[model samples]
Target: MNRSDMNNMAGSPYLLWRVGSLGLLAVVACVLAIRSFSPTARTRQGLMLAWAVAVVAIAASAFVVPEGVSDRALLNRIDPASGVKCATSIFVLSLPIVALLGALMGRAAPTQPRLSALASGIAAGACGAFVFAFCCPFNDPLYVVVWYSVGCAAVAGAARWRLPRRFRL
Candidate 1:
């Protein structure tokens, strides 16, 4: 998004709804991730639960913003890129977070290191999407679903792949 394009959206009337929805999902994802890391709780909850939460969070965040609240013009402006830029931005925003979550989970060394790392990644990805909500003005459900999901998935996948190695035993 260009500076002026961003400036133009300063008063965008629909931001509140998008941010609120994304924020709530982010919180849920974070909670699940944190819980999944607990050594005592690792067995009780595992990869399936982590994935379930991420899927639910994705569906809700995508559909939360209603259709009538915003016009198609904004999306038209962004439609050319097909949200690739947004995905990149979201990934960039979440990278530091992913690294931190990985380090924490690695240190904890839960019984299920792989699962915990995957959960950490999912949570970090959700948070990254949440952080990008401020800069993203497009309320298009399709746009949100496709690009945001990609961005979040990228982070989560990275964490999952790397964190399992922390467990030597």
Candidate 2:
């Protein structure tokens, strides 16, 4: 996008409203999965619920992007490094949450410590991404999926490696 386009959308309430609402929806679902999965129950319901929310979020993103614009075109709006910025932001905020969740899971005695901590880390990453959405100017669908997904995976990987070692079982 050009200067005028950037200026126009920079403070667009519609963009904020859409991203905020849907982003929170995604985060909440992930959190629910984390909450349920951390316990010993290990039911599939919570994970499935989170997956359903993810599907809805992905479908909604098609609408979020401007009609008829290619994914590459969307990056011109501002900050070619927006994906990296967003991803870094995700780590900064989510790491603490992941640690907290991991600590909780350790105390709760999950059936599989590593797996449970990893899942909770993913949810924590989503929570951080949701919080950063307000500050991240880039609203492209590709940017959201690629960088956010990376951030989640990175956190989850770290949690899997770190959290399991803390447990006795």
lDDT (Cα, tens digit) per residue for candidate 2, span 1-169: 1333556776665466445654765576456645654455553555566667666766666666655445345445434476777788888888878877866775675766655766676677777777776666555666676787677668767776888787776
Model 1 bad stretches (over 4 Å):
1-14, 42-82
Worst 10 residues of 2 by lDDT: 71-80
- Could you tell me how far off, in angstroms, the CA of residue 106 lies in candidate 2 after the best superposition? 2.5
In model 2, where do residues sit more than 4 Å from their true spots? 1-34, 37-39, 43-45, 71-80
- Could you tell me which 10 consecutive residues in candidate 1 have the lowest summed lDDT? 9-18
TM-score of 2: 0.74
RMSD of 1: 4.2
Model 1 lDDT at residue 134: 74
- TM-scores of the models, in the given order? 0.74, 0.74
